[model samples]
Target: MSLRRFTDELWSDIEPIYAEILEHPFLRGLTDGSLPRTAFRHFVEQDSLYLRDYARALALCGARAPETESVQAFLSDAAGAIAAEQEMLAGFGEELGEEPLSQEVLPTTRAYTSYLLAAAYGGSYAEAVAAVLPCYWIYARVGEQLLAKSSPDPLYARWIAVYGDESFQEIVRRVVALTDELAEQVSPAERQRMRERFTVASRYEWMFWNAAWIGERWPV
Candidate 1:
């Protein structure tokens, strides 16, 4: 389906979740780029683990999925996509004399892992596919705002640079389009249920960052 149609379907699934995200006091700062650099950095560190698991889970999905060709194709294409999302992070990290990629996964990453695992198991491949859309879409959206945030530390600049770059928008479009296609299952009611699931998932999306931002004193 076209991107607009995809957006229509995706909107049903994610709008409620997006609404919850908007209500988050912690993420509210993100609208205008007021989040603390320290918190944001910690969040990025946590994402390293999240991305690793995402790739792994996709790999599992590709392996077990009935149409291994299609599943493998998506996973293979997504392979190394996020890690190379932007080249600025390493430069910024180097400015801080830090390494961008780390070898370990943290507890914060579990939120994303649990999310994908649940969708992959509880829902169909299409649904699991639908559930994964926001990660890419929201990041691209958040990254644009973050890149524009004033006076970012060079380190953070590295991270935000990737999100703001227009090149990643295509990926977002692809994922969103893919989700809408996946949503074309049975009925509007089922689609609405998917939206509800998406909203619940979006809440966790907020908590993942809220936890990192406030370090476990995360507010609901």
Candidate 2:
């Protein structure tokens, strides 16, 4: 029921996918703020799209989630996350004086969203929990780091506010704990793979943001 245990289990499920994305140098630059503004903004737009899809998946899962369920309850809160993402995105978009993004979702964003949807529709309650944990785990890590220090840029302050805040951490902690319970039944090998995916997903988050903001323009 502990947070570490939950994240550990979730990690087992998604590590390989996470690792591949993390290896990108361009993604690193984006997270660190070395990238250009346009690219970062684009990343934000794309992320908004993904968040919306994730929310949809969560909503669908809720209808099927168990009545006395801990994992389902955790996911139930997740259904509201897209609104949070949109609020953060709006603040940043306004600061840049750009028009708001359209409803269009990017292909990469769609792929990740689809993955979560598939998990929600078909994975066991525990397995479904494992499949979705990465979204929370990496946000907790990044939000911790970004919020601890003053942001070097203004746009990033909102990122700090949304991701690095206390509330988001609490959400991550709860989910990790819930998922860790499921992970206990999962094999160590599966958990290891999930960890790899967790890391890669983290990196992809960076790339996703970068692709939106500064994109391939950064020495990629």
Candidate 3:
């Protein structure tokens, strides 16, 4: 099967989870402009935390990449992730008067980043790529959907625009293509492990948003 088909099949397995994410009150509120500012603020702050580690993970993937082109793609993605984080910080400043450093990392933020970083550091190269794919792919898909709805809130609209931008979508497509390419190089067992990593990361994406909606914090 072509890599696109493999990617599509992987997504099919997680389509129900994606559906839940779309129907989530946080996302619904975001599209309708009824989401409380506090929740969005929390999400922005946690995402700021998540992005730094995410960039590092991408860098790790770059380091592990066997080909020059793959290395360049991973590095470019790392740079883009860092840039996105800065943009998120600026958005928070404009919308909530929150400084990136002023926000503490939430538990979910820590857990999700830890999971990704671990995968990047310890998993095979294909698995590392797989671990990171959901973040890129899911946001692109959600952005397109949100753009079609077109939020009335400028903040929400700007957020959607960032993800829906053709440039960012291209990055997502590149990563998906990379994952499919890497999938072909690995053995069947390794491919299964890659899928497992993808699923875990995908689930983490859902949890990250849900955590923001609830304003998750340590019980202790």
Candidate 4:
């Protein structure tokens, strides 16, 4: 599908980051079932934490949105994020072991969610949308790519299926469409801010997976 000019522009800015993400060791391991269980567990744990805050940011965006449609879209997305996290985590109970996975917020996860919340709270609605877009967009894109090669590991394959499915892609398309709608109305400066927010979030997407591969923890 041909993207709107603004959406195209945003993707152009993140092409490099997205490429790096595709080549990340963590994703490579996921494809081959070679990822250490510990690392995957760490990723899941941090992801659970990330989803909680991510929902909050989405809610903020919903609350700040000018249109009822946009408000509904974001609020629905917020609910979906929470539900998806619960479902994903529940399926991993055995893989994560009977012991409760550590709920500690890894440094990268904290930084990423903090940036998202900050944008949702302080920036314009368009900027907030841009801030959260990468999670939806990158995951859908990565999911599709991974699906083409799908993982040998059932767990990894299941996870990939969730994002790669048509339903999830449709959800992402709705957000991208909203972005294009918002972009068409914004001033050049606001559009530039939106671009910046998208770029920053895209970079975080790479850092997030890389952190998981490295078993990131608070240094202090």
Candidate 5:
């Protein structure tokens, strides 16, 4: 079976969670333009922080990949991620007239980034790829869903367009293909580890959106 099929099967186990995410008030508000600016601002800031670390993790994956093609693909993804972060910053700056660098990283953002970095630095290539897949995969899914019922909010619409673009989907397809190829070579035990990592990261994707919805902070 292809890695995409395996991922789809795994996603079926968590499809309910993704459904919940789609129903999240924050996402709903975002799609409808009812989300408070404060909430969206918080999300943009935290995501900017998240993407920096995410790009680093992708770079680490590139360095660890065995094949030249895999290395090129991962490195390209790292660059693309960074570019997306920059675009987000610029878009938010124009919309909110605030600097992204001025915001502090929230606890949820920190936890998510730390987990991804640990996986990238310490886990096998397969594990690292699985760990990062949800961000790409889930965002694309969310984007397409939102785009289908697109909001009149230009800010939200612009955000949706980025993830829903065919280019982004192509990137995800390449990564999924790479993951399946790697899955074929690894031992059963290692494959299990990859699945575990994928599930954890998928949960983190949910938590990230929930945190923004709640405007979560370090309570200490």
Candidate 6:
């Protein structure tokens, strides 16, 4: 009998979260091109904020990696991919006539980034790898789903297409493979922590979209 891959188990734990993400009105709007402009703008702005910190987390993962190749992949290739994604988000800001750099990071965005940074700084290399996996994996999954039926709004279609790009998916696949390989070296207890971190990140994935959909802001 063959053992199940660690990622498969991680995925099974978050299947419900992924389902909710698919049903989210924000994503639904992306599919039908009916998402409000305000919400999309909010998403782009928050995403720009999110990516800045996410790049930092990726760098930490690189610094913490046991293998030199993993370190190089995270520090150079992964960081470059994030820079490209940030550029894409910047273009969206340009088209929308908004300056994301000037905007406040919403509650969800702050919480998610803080969680990732804490994981990277305070947790083990294995935990850091697990914490970052959901973002890469979930977006690629959503992108694949969105690609099957392109959006009518050119902007939304373009955004969906960015995530759906074969190149981006390849990057995500690399991360997924890395997660599985890392899991092999850890103890079962550590693997459990990895699972927990992956689940939290997955929930945050849903919350991030929901926050934009609802125009989440500081409740001052």
Which has the greatest lDDT? Answer: 4
Off by over 4 Å in 3: 1-4, 98-101
User: Would you give me the overall lDDT of model 4?
Assistant: 0.91
TM-scores for all candidates?
A: 0.71, 0.73, 0.95, 0.96, 0.94, 0.95
Q: TM-score-based ranking, best first?
A: 4, 3, 6, 5, 2, 1
Q: Which of 1 and 5 is the better model by TM-score?
A: 5
**Model 3, residue pairs in steric clash:** none
Error of 1 at 78 (Å): 4.1
Candidate 6: global Cα-lDDT?
Answer: 0.90
Query: What value of lDDT does candidate 3 attain over all alpha carbons?
Result: 0.87
lDDT of 6 by residue, 28-112 (tens): 9998999998999888888888887888999999998888989998888557757765786667778887444446888999999
TM-score of 6: 0.95
On a 0 to 100 scale, what is the lDDT of residue 83 in model 6? 78
**What tens-digit string does per-residue lDDT give for candidate 3 at 1-220?**
5335668767987898899989999999989999998888888888988999999999999999989998998898899889888987875557786344446877898998999999999998899999999999999999999989978998888888888889889888888887878777889999899889989899999999999899888888
Local accuracy of candidate 2 as per-residue lDDT tens digits, 1-220:
6445556544545565455544544445445656566666666667777777677666655666565566366456665676667675766667755677655676557667777777667655555555566677766765665566535666665666677778778878877776566567778766554454445445456556545643433232
lDDT winner between candidates 4 and 5: 4
Over 4 Å off, model 4: 1-4
**Candidate 3 minimal-lDDT segment of 10 residues:** 93-102
Q: In candidate 4, what are the lDDT values of residues 91-169, reduced to their tens digit?
A: 8856779998777888999999999999998899899999999999999999999999888999888888888999999
Q: Which is superior by TM-score, 1 or 3? A: 3
Q: What is the lDDT of residue 83 in candidate 1?
A: 57
**lDDT (CA) for every model shown?**
0.61, 0.61, 0.87, 0.91, 0.86, 0.90
For model 6 the local lDDT of residue 81 reads 55
Off by over 4 Å in 2: 1-6, 9-33, 67-72, 185-207, 213-220
Candidate 1 lDDT, tens digit per residue, 82-147? 455233345334443454544445555666678777876777666666566567677787676566
Candidate 2 vs candidate 4: the TM-score winner is 4
